[model samples]
Target: MIIQPKQRNIAYRCPECASSIFGIVGKFALSADMLRLKCSCDKGSALDINKTNDGKIRLSVPCLFCKQNHSYVVSESVFFDRDKFLLNCPYTGMDIAFIGDEQTVNSELARTEEEIRRLMAGFEAEDISELQPEDMNEDEILPDPAVYDTLRFLVKDLEAEGKLECLCNEGSYELRFCDGGVQVYCERCGATYTFGATTPALAEEYLNIDYLKLK
Candidate 1:
């Protein structure tokens, strides 16, 4: 018997900006191991889907949801059994993206458009301050509280002492928190430093080093 090729479709969105990145559909053989795509944002962030050795699909991608990159693994059946797989931000429980077959994605997009229209039909301005990410509880919104707090304090301290200023005389640095850690970046110079925690107390140790040592 001849086996039919599997077709896949993926829809991406940056939860932080509530923006739709893109929708792509393609066909692959049963032996295909991985698929990769990029976000629509100017950042051109990456997203990857890999077929693991254990016959599961693993999604390793940058999340616009919590401003971090992380990985997620799902059973192989997820592709064939469901019309869509909605991936959520593990930290904030916000919908980050969806993947499935082409037909399902098109249908889902139509439904979403209709709902958007219905809501906008009677839309009105309201105070949206409560919706801001900063207003969210750090412990609840961060995937790893210990790492978040440790890095948050360290970066804030560095910034306060002017240790985070770019040598190119550009500007100060800022932190973007994600699943397991944070990204330190300079806006004008585009420099970045990343820290993560794979074991207990790793982030804490990294935060305790002297400023000179950090440089």
Candidate 2:
């Protein structure tokens, strides 16, 4: 009996020279919906396959020559050949090639931060005049309430209290800190992974541990 490794279904083409290149597919993270491929030309390209179907997938990297980001697409084929992934930059005609996979930790972390920011923004734009404090017909003074300030203070307080936590973009197990370990778990998924200890001394040792927003 013989054992065989799984084969790839990669394909790419160059933008400038229209050259074809082969790639080695590696790192398939189903949890993160990610796939990584290394191009033969020595340039590495990382993509989010989950985003491809919706036309949201783009080269994980910004355009090297143009520095332009949008308007790029990263699609896959059931019968794709690695040769299709190779291409020259249409704008610069440079040898545009790539190899390698996206680090799920980094990409997912950045994506979570982005979601947090967007949520903060939406919370900011909300009209809270009705929820504001103002003077009444009487001569009584009032406090501003300061919901945002309070929230910020709570965030800091939680960190100091060793309860700082956050959630990743996946909307699953939250990034919670306890016993000096960052855990990813949800009652539903039951997925939990300890990241690091609760102290700074061990922070470096378990630097790669994933964290979640404190609830």
Candidate 3:
């Protein structure tokens, strides 16, 4: 008879691009000095797992909400024995990383995404009249906040599904908002995709985009 090694699913939202990253960690891997899980954005956003000499586990997590990296340490048993474990950002109380069975990790990620959408919608409901004249920069024309947020959400969703790409295969993409539209550009190779985001109709049209290639 053979005993299978214990394994756990891990997931985190990238601080740089807000894309969900998923991976699996095996019990044997914990025996090593360190393990790193990186996001596809290739922007230095990653989760690090380190094994201490005292037989404990150390986790370095990147938080999408706080835009920060947080560190925590726990016993080996707590790290590997739990059916579900979540690490959250202290500032926002937002879950930064998830470790557990595949189903639970995926469910938590979906819930988090839905919660963020609702929060953004709530912000959009605020009165536009509340903005003071001092808040406007005469020389800077900003894009519609709601439209920009929608574009950002769509871009991250595409990124998570591996549907966003760049002409230069090695380059990773990032999103930028302009006066009337949004841009998806590769940081390394300068490949770009620009499209209008001045209206909800334009943003909704992108929902049908199954793949995007920056050139």
**Top TM-score: which candidate number?**
3
Using Cα atoms with residue i matched to residue i, what is each candidate's TM-score against the true structure? 0.46, 0.24, 0.54
As for TM-score, the candidate ahead, 2 or 3, is: 3
Cand. 1 TM to true fold: 0.46
**Tens digit of lDDT per residue, candidate 1, span 48-100?**
77777877566755654345555665555555455566554545444356677
lDDT of 3 by residue, 76-173 (tens): 65567666777655334456688888999999899888876676576673322222123443225444444544555566557656788887667655
Off by over 4 Å in 3: 1-5, 125-215
lDDT digits (tens) for residues 39-136 of candidate 2: 33434333323345553333433233333221233333311222223222323333233332333323433444464346447668332232222423
RMSD, each candidate, Å? Answer: 17.0, 19.5, 17.2
Q: Which regions of candidate 1 fall more than 4 Å away from where they truly are?
A: 1-5, 15-19, 23-30, 107-141, 144-215
Clashes of each: 0, 35, 0
Return the top candidate by lDDT.
Answer: 3
Off by over 4 Å in 2: 1-50, 54-57, 78-80, 99-215
User: What lDDT does candidate 2 reach at residue 22?
Assistant: 41
